[model samples]
Every structure is written in structure tokens, then in C-alpha cells.
Target: MTAIELTGVTKRFGDVVALRDLDLAVEDGEVFGFLGPNGAGKSTTINLLLDFARPTEGRAEVLGMDAQRRSQEVRRRTGVLPEGFRTYDRLTGRQHVEFAIDSKEANNDPMDVLERVGIAEAADRKVGGYSKGMTQRLALGMAITGEPELLILDEPSTGLDPNGAREMRELVREERDRGATIFFSSHILEQVEAVCDRIGILRGGELVAEDSVSGLREAAGTAQTLEVTVSRADEELVASVRTVEGVSNVTASGDRLSVACDPDAKTRVLERIESEGVTVEDFSTEEASLEELFVSYTTDEQAASEQRGRTSDGKNSEGEDDERTESESESEEVRA
Candidate 1:
């Protein structure tokens, strides 16, 4: 079953487009991660799924129902830890959980939910006295009250310390094991990389990549750096290695040559080196990390924007300098 689907969805805030021609689907009984940098339309997509805002074009469906027309039904079957959720200052933690249960018409034990979230000891404390992490725990407890079929968490680890974050991830796994579809959203790649069954990366209001962690690593064209210590290294050997398909950035320093290429291309590079008559002594390969892969996919637009800004600034500075020179020339001519 499809837990959530967005087809050709576009959301415009006046002149600014938040999401554009976006298409995505999260299946039932899996943990899906929505990953992106800030202002990448992750929140806007969530809002559309919950009917907090309507899309300017296309459709959003949650649990096989139209998100806009059947929002109440969607909310009833879905548990959400919404971004920037707030608590009633005077209400106790237990009260918050009870409110959620009542709203869902669910027969959940408020104390049990508090215990599950590791906040049973503070169940009676007023929310105004709770620390940020404590409040986040209470909100999570509220979200899981009814054991909803689908869970949508937006930055669920926001205020958590390292240990608290680990605990939260464990709970996500538990929820998924209990036959609930989990949609986890975060800007932190490490957080979701561990728990997610599949991940979708959003950039410039579009879904740029979606796949398992290993699949994404491959699709991102992340390569391994192979460093070979040879009996001899020279310009000719380096040039030959560079000519091999998929091998790139080959550099020679003394008896060591460093070549950047995909894992599969490592053998081909070695063959080329041997063909060039350089005896290999030893070699080591360093694979690209997940963080590196994340940056590679998401930073292109940002880098381009920065480059454009620098070019514009340079042009404006040149123009100003030319104007000053022309003005000085005009003043000199008048004096003459």
C-alpha cells in the first residue's frame, strides 16, 4: 500500500516557489527519510500532506486518500511530530498525552506512553518547567499515543543530545517493526542514514535522488582514492593511468601515485600502471563517506549561486572603477 504520494505537486508563495513538479511516494511498512538542506521544501511538502497548505498545482495523497479533501481522516490514522510543535505551558506531560489520545478517540494509557518515551518520571511536571529535550520527549509521547498506522516526524531529533538522539532512533526502529510506516525528515544525514530503509534528497524544491544508502552512494558517483606506492613513478605512468576510463585526478609524488576513481575502476588503473612498466609495491583505497556523498548531491545549486554572486560583485566593482576613472578624465579636461 502507498502510505503517501505526491504527484506533480507545486506550491508557490506569491513569487517564490517552495515545491515544483515534485513527485514522491512512501510505501507502507518502511522507514523513509526526507533529507535536504534548509529551505529545500521539506516542510512545505509535509504541510501539503497534512493539508496545512494546499498545493498550487497537482495532488497529495496520504493513506490512499486525497490530502486536501480527506485531511481529517488522514490525521486520525497518522501520528505526526510536526516541526516546531508547541505545548501548553500550564499542562503537565500526562495531560498532553491524554489530550492526544482523546483527540484520536484512542484508548491508550497516558502513563504507558510517557514510559515509552522515557519521561514517565516527569509525567506530572508542567511543560513550562521542562527543558527543550524533555519537551521533545513529551511531544514524541503524544505522537505515538494511538499507535497510528503511519508516523511523520519532521526533525524529530532537533533538541536531543547525542544519547537522546540515539534513543529516538531506537524508538523509530521499534515503531517501524510494529508495522507502522515511518516518514522521517531531517537536515542531518547521519541521523536518518542509520534508520531509514530508503532516502530522498530534496534540492531546489525538487527530488534529486531517492534510493537506499548504498544505492545513493553509487548514484552520487562517489569514488575511492587509490594511493599506490610503486618502484617508480613518472609523468608517463601518471598520464597512462589518467587515460584509463573512469580514472581521474591522477597525481604522482616521488614513488607514490594517487588516483581518484570508482571502486570498480581501481583494477583497471592498476592494469594500466603495470602496462606502463611501473612495478607496484603496495596500494590502499579510501572510500568516500556518506557525508561526502550528501554534500556532493545537495551543494551544486548552492555553489552555483555563490559563483554567480561573486561574478556579479566583480562586474559591479569594475563598473564603479571605470565610472571613477571617466569622471576624473572629465574633470581634467574641464581644467585644461
Candidate 2:
């Protein structure tokens, strides 16, 4: 079941078009990452879904309700943390959470939400005195308090430290496991890569790519980087290791052998090293991260757009020249 659906949704502000024929679908109980660079219509699409901004054309539906006509009903069933969010500065953490629960008319205990977010100790502290990371945690506490069926998080990890970010990702997963569909928007590729089941990449108000991290990696033709460390380095062993199936490139540096290969080829490479009398002290693998994937898609899309712009410019120039020649011929006839 789809929790959200957008078909040919278009939104504009005066002359600036925010979304153009945007089509998106988010599955139930799945963590879907909405990815894009700054000004890529990620927030606009979210606004349309929330009915914060009405679309100029097309349709949007959330939880089987028309997004525009039944916005309040949709809002009641979904939780949202908008991009660069700020909470009530004067309110204590507990106060903020309890307020949200009251607004939602939810029966859940506020203490449980605060504890799950690791803010139980600071629950009585004013949010104005909280650190950026603490404030982010508080926002998340409120967003998840009502146990809404769908969570819409925008840049949820922006102010979080590494540990805080990890905890936030865990919370998202926990909610997903409990049957909530998470539609999160972020440019922080690492967190999204770690938590999201699938991703949609939007560029210049258009969604150009949508797939799993592995699917995008395959599409990008990305190779895995493997590093194996041992007690000692052996030149002959490195060369021999390159003979492993699917090992595309290999090099030796100090006590480690670095190999670039298919993601699934690491086990074979390690097995071959062991068979050849090489002792492995440590082995690690790194695939193309979401950062790499985002950059690859954005670069390709930018290049394609520039090429189309040049082609259009050339066509317009040719048409102008033809128009000038026709005008000159008409003037000559008048002179005759």
C-alpha cells in the first residue's frame, strides 16, 4: 500500500516554477529518502503533500485522502518536522512534548517519548538553553510523540553530532519497524544512506532518479574499495592477489593491500589471499557512499541540462538569422 502519491503535481510562485510535473509514490512502512541539492523542490513537494501549498496543477494524495481537500485530516494522521525547524524557546522539553501530545489528542505518555529520545534527564530544562543538538532531539521527540502513521522529517539530522545522528537514525528505524512510513528529506547523504530503504533524487525541480542505494550504485557503475591489512607487506603476494576473480585494480601500501572490485567480490579476494599463504590481520570494504551517488547524478543531470540549453540557443540564433534575411528581401522588393 502506498502511503503517499503525487501525480503530475505542479507548483509555481509568480514566474518561478517550484515543481514541474512531479510524480512520486512512497510505500507503506518504508523509509523513503527525498534527496536533492538546495533549490531542488524537495520542500515544495513536501508542502504540497501537507497542503501547506496548493499545487497549480495535478493531484496529491496522502493516506487515501485528497491532499488539498482533506488537508486537516491528513495533518492529523501525519507528523512533520519542517526543514531548519525551531521549537518554543521558553518551554521546557517536557512542556513541549506534552503540548504536542495534547494537540494531537494522543493518549501516549510524554515520558516515554522523552526517554526514547535520550532527553529524559533534561526534560525539565528550557529549550532556549539547550544546545543545537539538544534542540534537534526535542523536535524529534514531539514529531514522534503522537505515533502517527506517517512521519515527514525535513533535514532531521542537521544539528546533530555523530552519536546524536546515529541515535536519530535508530529512532527512525524503530518507528518503521512499528509500521510507520517515514518520508524524510535531507542532503546529509550518510544518514539517509544508512537508514533509507530507497531514495528519490530531485534536481532543478525534477526527480531524475529513484532506487535503492545498491540500485543507484549499479546504475553509476561504482566499484567497491577494499582494504586488507596484515602484519607485513608482500609485493609478490599483492600481485598474486590481483588474480582473484572480479578484482579490477590492486595496489600495496605498507602493511595493506588496497583492491577495487565488485562489491560481492570481497569474499573471493580474501579467500584467494588465504589460499596463497597470506595472513590477513584486518579486512574492510567500502562501497560507493550516498554522497558519491548524489554527486554523480547531479553532475550528469547538470551536464545534460547545459547541453540542451546550448542546443536551444543555437536553434534560436538560426531562426533569428532567417527572419532577418526574409525582412531584407521584402525591403528589396519595396525598393524595386
Q: Which structure among the candidates has the greatest lDDT?
A: 1
Candidate 1 has which clashing residue pairs, if any? none
Per-residue lDDT of candidate 2, residues 22-135 (tens digit): 999999989999988878898999899888899999999999899999998998889888876678899899999999899899877888989998989999988899999888
Candidate 1: tens digits of C-alpha lDDT, residues 183-269: 999999999998999999998899988999879777645677789999889766765565455654566899999887778889888
Candidate 1's error at 63, in angstroms? 0.4
Instruction: Please give the lDDT score at residue 327 for candidate 1.
Output: 40
TM-score per model over all chains: 0.75, 0.71
**How does candidate 1 score on lDDT?**
0.85
| Model 2 misplacement above 4 A | 222-290, 300-336
